[model samples]
Target chain A: ATERPEALLLVMPTDHAIPDVDAFRAAVAAGVPRAVAGQIVTFGVRPDRPETGYGWIEVRGAPVDGVAQRVERFVEKPELARAEAMLAEGRYLWNAGIFLVSAKTLVAAVTAHAPDLIEPVGEAVAEARGDLDFLRLSEGPWSGVRDISIDFAVMEKAANIEVIPLGTAWSDLGDWNAVWRENGGGIVTQGAVTAIDCEGSLLRSEVGGQHVVGIGLQDLVVVAMPDAVLVADRARSQDVKTAVAQLKAKAVRQAEVFPRDHRPWGWFETLALADRFQVKRIVVKPGAALSLQSHVHRAEHWIVVSGTAQVTVGEDVKLLTENQSVYVPLGAVHRLANPGKVPVVLIEVQTGAYLGEDDIIRYEDIYARGDEQGPKR
Target chain B: ATERPEALLLVMPTDHAIPDVDAFRAAVAAGVPRAVAGQIVTFGVRPDRPETGYGWIEVRGAPVDGVAQRVERFVEKPELARAEAMLAEGRYLWNAGIFLVSAKTLVAAVTAHAPDLIEPVGEAVAEARGDLDFLRLSEGPWSGVRDISIDFAVMEKAANIEVIPLGTAWSDLGDWNAVWRENGGGIVTQGAVTAIDCEGSLLRSEVGGQHVVGIGLQDLVVVAMPDAVLVADRARSQDVKTAVAQLKAKAVRQAEVFPRDHRPWGWFETLALADRFQVKRIVVKPGAALSLQSHVHRAEHWIVVSGTAQVTVGEDVKLLTENQSVYVPLGAVHRLANPGKVPVVLIEVQTGAYLGEDDIIRYEDIYARGDEQGPKR
Candidate 1:
């Protein structure tokens, strides 16, 4: 917390911002001592354009030695000429998503300007809970506050906000173009990508997925996420939020999320699709068991491909190994357990007229999934 | 072939010389009556430019009754201004790939001027060997013949080389740009592409093999092949032959061909890589088996993920079902057979200090891979 006559690093993080860990570390190592002199240290990013996409900072007057003059005022992205002027004069920064401060000075400064943030943040820190190396802020206070960025509530009103021009490469990774810029362009392919005439774009496919191909495209973003695919122009990538909003508005099952949700127990994914039938690849961790339940509308066929599967079907219990299979009729009380010490992988083919999450009638659940179950998270 | 009115077709391939198929077809279709009565038929193409890329025909004298013209002389693509003057004069026609003529008239003209081609072509056809669906021409006398296009070898020398300009949309498909134009400019990825200052461009990506992402590029042709990738300027695409020659010179595996070699059985692909180890996903068709072989430097591990695998390790044999595994030590002869009526899918992990195709020693074979040891086509 002590300033050591090094530079003060200012980091401002936007919501959903994931700052480059390496750059933040580099900035800290470069500016620790200069911060002791009460000189300002802030990171300045080159504006991507006269971007209505970001908040703009205008540095007024000349530099006081190495420290920049006080910021005149914060302004949102301006008209075209002003943006061009900003690019020409080159003093303004794009308000990089991060900032670092001299512990003593920033606390003093924030207390003077925005007392509400400082007190709650201080209390939260004092009473902060730690679990698994993560600092969990008390949700009651952290989420209760008005949704406002530090730029709006604090930085704009500060008087001695000096600028540190970031000539080093930086990217917000706010969208696909940023991702493309991060990845050196040309021949960008993930999972067997075939592309032609694509420029300044990111084409990605997740693991265990089909190959993706892009042809004669330039400056576009193609993402193959589980359950949903996203194809958008790089310039219009910010509108993905609108896509997500539309998905929510439409109540689309695919857009809501992937059907095979990942958990600590291992994940399950569906492979076969039909109106009356579905097949799933089921994997369970060692000694894990599924809930004791039955599908009201569906019957299931289980093929034990590997490991040992202990099945309780109605009045009978049996252990199945590789090359063995079983069938569970609808409404029959059934539970699958991996009684062995090895991961169990199996295929379950389900037949039903209606296959939806709501059809699952859980009788008892060890993983806390039913109504009587506790919140698992 | 019978004579038909008002429907003349010509198939003029873009090559040095051959009798046009459409011309022959048109000749057959037009019969002797209509052609002699002056209902002329012909094929015409628009010139790209004063392109040395094609052969140009010039018409002299005036149009005779708006039906026929005296083809004074055939001038190949000339200097730019002269070609422009030819176009301006509006009395020239770029030879359409096809020419239509009445059978009687064409046979008579060929007999008068190109009698040599007629005899050999006639013998070649009479003695043509039947191979599958195609008529294979024997090389004996056919190869001895002079290589000349029917247009130059016959039409130019004929007394009645009528010119009827049929302005149907046509393309030679002689270049990448022409193919792209025919398929639509944005055929690869459509309007998803945005070119900024790029010109004279041809970009194409094969599905599931390559994806091109471009930035700050111009006049470039980028083709994504299955195994190898190509990036060349449009002007230099013609020089791709040079690149292929270099690759052949260097004996690079990808330069000459692709990695996915088709076979009688199912295919195999590399899945994992390490300096001393390489893993492959091998799929065997039902009733298919690998050759009995041994590797001096490499050992292999096979884990059956699907279907039944019949494994022969030295003198012993075993049937391994899904989720079962096996290990083959170095210098130990082993062969895998898929005797079940289902495809066998397995993950094979191989480890060796030096792993190359040349390391395998085959003893007994099933698919004739060891016979004569020809290149895997």
Candidate 2:
């Protein structure tokens, strides 16, 4: 009780699905006392199936709700046979990698185990800058920080590690199969999907107009986005990483970038692009303004499809309403702003010799991005 | 042999793939004499695999080159076991549905059997009209004719049907699996696709820039188009028909229509569409002209991305080249024509209260479609 502290920190992966918030809160509250007492606490979920895709954690004794248990050992994701055996043993739980610990204890564990990582990571945080909202770490120090999970660097080597049995359904959702499993198991259909005679499949289309069809298929995952589609055997969902690497090696833009580019104010999607022209659907939040910019090699036509837009071309400033348009000739300085209560939606047609996003030259920006030229637009 | 006539009619399915032209010509040449001698000749290919998706012909005698054999019973697409057994039997051949027969004999045979079809079909031919390069059959009579295949309507009932062995590579391309087979099997890929640790799979993206990723997939078919994505078991390729029918029942447009709308001139593909806006990339064939028309509900902005376009807006007629654009206001009679030797490619952005294809009122059309507006352009 002498090591007990007043504050404790809980670490969880943001992308994981833990739908029962109250149950999760109760489990975290249960672990907090042990964590404050200088015992690094991990949470474990009872397994319902012999899932070979997740790490299994063995407990020393019977697990009780709201009670921390002594850790036996950590096991990596096992083969089907091993997973079945572990499931039959009745003491193994899914290692969800959730952790509860005091800040001092985590720091001490990291320093004791991965001593080499402490300096660069600490420097990165020390030199971080507040960019409007986000605290961006220093690039130079961050680049030197080794890319590793806390479990491999600290939990696996710590001596005072303990686990609390979480009384809620949880899933890491590490891959598409996990997503399929999280959607209640039998033929998960999401967004513009039709399944005929399909079982244990995930047929998903991310966009509204893109329909996904599955026929006479078993245990498959088909995910369709605007620019890319992924089809994989549900059992082999983890192997999608290698396919992504192959796409990256071939310089496919979809490997690293999404079709919709999000910005501080709103977002824009390239509807169509070709050699000398590009069409974009842009939405600007109310009171948001794009940087005063112009392209040397392109002329743009902006049509206000919805809401109101305050448009500026050269020295002329005009308010364009729905179904109104303006043409910005090549080299003309222009700016588009949503000065109304609603978001401004516009269709922009760019005609140019080179229509790359890098062709922009910003003269002024209200969002504090003045001269920096990137693909943010 | 007196059944032979001086003229022969060879019928083949246009959708079939017969890559060996010389071999096909030789086989046709061999069957020509037999067909001219008043025999109804049907071509059969040697079975290469246990294909359950195609009809099988049981031949009594060993096949010889340029020789005809007496007709045997026609077996429909069989189960896997029957297909495998037939594949093992050396006397079985794939009934390709190609037929060679004399016109007089076919008409006489058709008159003898299936007597009800002759009147409606003959009336449809009698009332046919020439529209450009296509012979337009009278819909009244054509609709009265039963939707039946030649095999079921005539060939199966005809006692004079004889089989001719054709030594040529062929494929009906009945479904995605047949496309995979045509593409040379074992991990067939088309367009932008990346595969990792995959075997016996067909991963295809119908349009460029749409990348398809397949990982650890086996015996599967994945096809991604602009409007729809289909993932199915390779052996269940034929069942895609049921999926399509289900889509049709659900009133999915992709089930019946393609994304690209083809006109007599060229084609246009819709890049994006919203409630009141539509963007299309249109390519007009050289020397082709859209109808002199006006839309009451929508206005259009046409940006010439490539080649040259002769534009007509009211009394103003201008030739716009690459990187140039023109605006056609609502209720203004406008026309777009490709007067240059090369095709004209343009991006059309429409903004309106109602942007339906039926909103057009045409004055004149060089393609001879006048006074009848049923969604041509």
- Which candidate number would show the highest TM-score if scored against the true structure? 2
In model 2, pairs of residues that clash are B3-B37, B3-B38, B4-B36, B4-B37, B4-B38, B5-B36
DockQ per model, Cα:
0.04, 0.57
Error of 2 at B69 (Å): 5.7
lDDT of 1 by residue, A1-377 (tens): 33442335455545323346665556544444445656445666656566666666777753222343456666675787787787677667776645556767776677777777875676666666654235656655665566676676666776656565454556677777667766676546675344545576677765232334454556666665434445556776777776656556656545555657554456687553444555566787777787777878877767665689999999999998764567687799998888999978776656567766567767776654464322221
lDDT of 2 by residue, A175-290 (tens): 98888877888989889899988898898899666789888888888899888898888888888887878888899988888788877668898887777888999999898889
Kindly report which residue stretches of model 1 are placed more than 4 angstroms away from their true locations once superposed: A1-61, A64-69, A74-98, A102-153, A164-377, B1-175, B186-236, B246-253, B264-266, B271-274, B279-289, B303-309, B319-325, B337-347, B366-377
Task: Give the alpha carbon lDDT tens digit for every residue of B1-377 in model 1.
Answer: 12543333344566322235464344334433445543324444445555554556666753332244445667765777788777677667676556655555566676788788877776676666653334656556687677987767776777666564433345556665555545555423322232333345555544231223333444555454434444444554445555556556656555554455445567776543435555556788898777788888877767666789999989989998765667787799999889999998776656567767668888876555564353331
Candidate 2 lDDT score relative to the true structure: 0.85
Q: Compose the digit string of candidate 2's lDDT tens values, residues B122-228.
A: 89988877665578787789989988888888888888888888888888987888889888899999888998878999988985667899877889899998888
Clash count (model 1, backbone only):
35
Question: Per-model C-alpha lDDT, please?
Answer: 0.60, 0.85
